[model samples]
Target: MSVSPTSQGQAAIFIPTPNYLFSASVNLGTPLAPIPLLEGGQRIVEPITGGTIGGPGFQATIEGGLAAPIVLNSGDGTKTQLAFIYAYGHAQDGSPFYLEESGIGGGPAQTTRIIMNVGGKFQALQKMYILAQPKVNEAKTLASVECYSVPTPV
Candidate 1:
């Protein structure tokens, strides 16, 4: 008796790999004082005044943006949960790319950090395949970021 060669072969699996996208240096205006809520968390807003996003084959000028962040403290008051939604305008190749970012942060109140993911659509055709990858921006503040495109399953 003999076994088939196909039975012994392993299946091929495709996984995504991350590629560097762009680095953005954001300049944020003064944050509107936090508004405390009677029931819980506080609401904060910040303005994105100006910045630059650049990388190989692509670069953009950050025209404007806004961020609304909410912070909720645990009953014990030792830990906090943060959620934020931000949107920005990018001028690239004589067109506009509207980008939005959102994320959640949880940790000790004193050392909380945000790991944001970004997605956007362009008005004109461009190297969209690079943009389709999962883009992540991790930072304590929105001052600066290194963006990357990670692979995903189809």
Candidate 2:
């Protein structure tokens, strides 16, 4: 017996493949303390030659292998300017893991937040990437990540 051309089993079947999805949602609000302005350290919305604010910097990490344009959401406080630096390291596969530098050969996209003040709930986005660094002879991975922004003049 032959299946009919118009039958559900033989209607010139066309199975479409699933498309690739790239993107992630990261929660950055984890009660972060003010990053102290240190000597010789670059900060957001502040000149590199200015004195340190003498506070603690915002620190957090994200899951590696996230597609470009990672969304960083933090419900804490507000300020001006933000920076996300991707630390280079090795992956579990022993392959070098690195996030392309901003503006480097079509590097990963980035988005900055314009916080108004500090001491309250706030949210922001960080599109940059933080390379994955798997521990030697270990399965866990780590990446040193930090966020910075300046408060509006009172």
Candidate 3:
């Protein structure tokens, strides 16, 4: 008789915890009307007016951006959201950064992937994988996203 170990199929470079990066509070403008697409898909485009972002050693103002989401029925009396967002911001010390994100979810716990190109002290984020949890208020006027840096094994 022999015993064999089973695997959960996770990658070898998987890191359980991620480092805290920053949190962004975004103010939104009124969204444009939803345009109907084929196969019951609806496209909604919104504008990001302004906001703020702060973290351990960085603070910045969110200048502007766009949010375009395509929604489709899930056939279970629910809908699914696929969001694509972009933001351009600058820090207090004149450092500029750009952020792009994509997520799929209709609930508050959205698992988002973030990519940021920043200068100044936060330049280390250039090679790191970023993940975020974003939450938007019911009024759709404000959004708060908590970002983290994922460290992988070499």
Candidate 4:
């Protein structure tokens, strides 16, 4: 599938191939606090304690980050978070990296784009199209984060 964001009659935009990047189970610490509002909705601020990610030619350790997701209630016993993450880590070879993701948390099949930065040998990541899939646990203490890259032409 492809995306067509046209002005008048422009052609469809390019769709890159799904390039697997990495997958990891992100560990979380307790949230600082919940700022409740909107009649049962709240904003959650959780800390990303640690994790690991590896795929293809890279393997990295998750250092720390912040998770700030706005929880919205449907009034029907359902709630979902408008989630955002700022994660950082280091490659096994001592290369530092950072990743940012924005998507829904506590929902099924939710995927969103990833903005990443890398140093050392993995610097090519800055020029690639990336995506992330994250699933939060019931206790809100863990997230399984998987990232993918869409291969674009040079």
Candidate 5:
């Protein structure tokens, strides 16, 4: 059998604009001892003791048990890069949420700045929606969150 290249259907691509969900400042407690990785990377787990979330109609404190494990990759020797983290929190009404963020950040260890894409899921209630049908039924929003990190006083 022989194969041939042929023009096919048009590709449909949609770029979603990230709706501003909220701005949160996370407080990462003192990091635990770094666990050496096999690939010359180090895994560090920081405790997310507390924080705050603010948006259009929601505000809440970030719950504990949220551990952010950042894997630092030794890159060009000038600076170490790459970090990945997963965190969880709750809204003022006790509704829960989780966030996953990954990006490259490098500088001094204590003042390193991380720019990462944060995304998470949350349940929506009647108050959060105008339509009655969606408000009453099981509703949720998968949000693309924008987040930045700053060293907080412990």
Candidate 6:
């Protein structure tokens, strides 16, 4: 997707700020993409042919654990503060993973949220997908964090 045009007198290409940022590999456990949710917070696995309802959501991770503070910036020196909600765990793929919690934790804000500590390596390698909902804009995007870790012998 195209990022918001940079201020005049600036470069022509405005690098879209990544709404979702991650520190490490945390499997999403499943190929759960385009997770469908209808009005009134009802989950739907089937596709909705047509309907104007809520927007999309995302998944992300902070290296080690999010038990600490997360910094958000506008990519450039611009300090348009942003907020985020994150979770950690493994996907249903039988590997370790993490994800953002539902509700307010993932809501918008001007400051950063103190995430909970998520530690542990999955028994097997897994791929991760991070979905982000930009607060300032309507368009949303998905990012994947792939992990290829080999166990170290004791």
TM per candidate comes to 0.63, 0.21, 0.86, 0.79, 0.52, 0.21
lDDT of 5 at 87: 57
lDDT of 3 by residue, 26-140 (tens): 9999999998997788999999999999997358999999988788887787887887899998987788989899988875567889888888877877778888888889999
lDDT (Cα atoms) of all candidates against the true structure: 0.55, 0.25, 0.84, 0.80, 0.45, 0.29
Instruction: Estimate the TM-score for candidate 3.
Output: 0.86
Ordering by TM-score:
3, 4, 1, 5, 2, 6
Colliding pairs, model 3: none
Question: What would the per-residue lDDT of candidate 1 be over residues 52-79, giving only the tens digit for each residue?
Answer: 8788534778777776667787777654
* Winner of 4 and 5 under TM-score: 4
| Model 4 local distance difference test score | 0.80
Per-residue alpha-carbon lDDT of candidate 6 for residues 47-148, written as tens digits (9 for 90 to 100): 111111111222322332221112223446343322333544432233334434222222342222222333333222222222323231122222223212
In angstroms, the error of model 4 at 89 is 1.8
What is the full ranking by lDDT, best candidate first?
3, 4, 1, 5, 6, 2
Q: What are the per-residue Cα lDDT tens digits for candidate 4 across 10-114?
A: 876876668678887789998977898766689888999998888884589999998887888786877787878888999877989998888775565567677
Candidate 5, 82-147: lDDT as tens digits: 545455667666666555544455642222222222223334422131110001011211112232
Supply candidate 1's per-residue lDDT for 9.
Answer: 72
Off by over 4 Å in 4: 1-15, 37-40, 75-77, 105-109, 152-154
Clash list (residue pairs), candidate 5:
none
Poorly placed runs, candidate 2 (over 4 Å): 1-21, 38-79, 85-154
Q: Which model, 1 or 3, shows the larger TM-score?
A: 3
Q: Give the TM-score of candidate 4.
A: 0.79
Tens-digit lDDT track of model 2 for 1-154: 1222466565553433322112212322222233445432223221111111111322222233221222222355323222433333332233333333221111122243212122211112132122221111122121122223322222
In candidate 5, stretches whose alpha carbon ends up further than 4 angstroms from where it belongs are 1-12, 78-82, 100-154
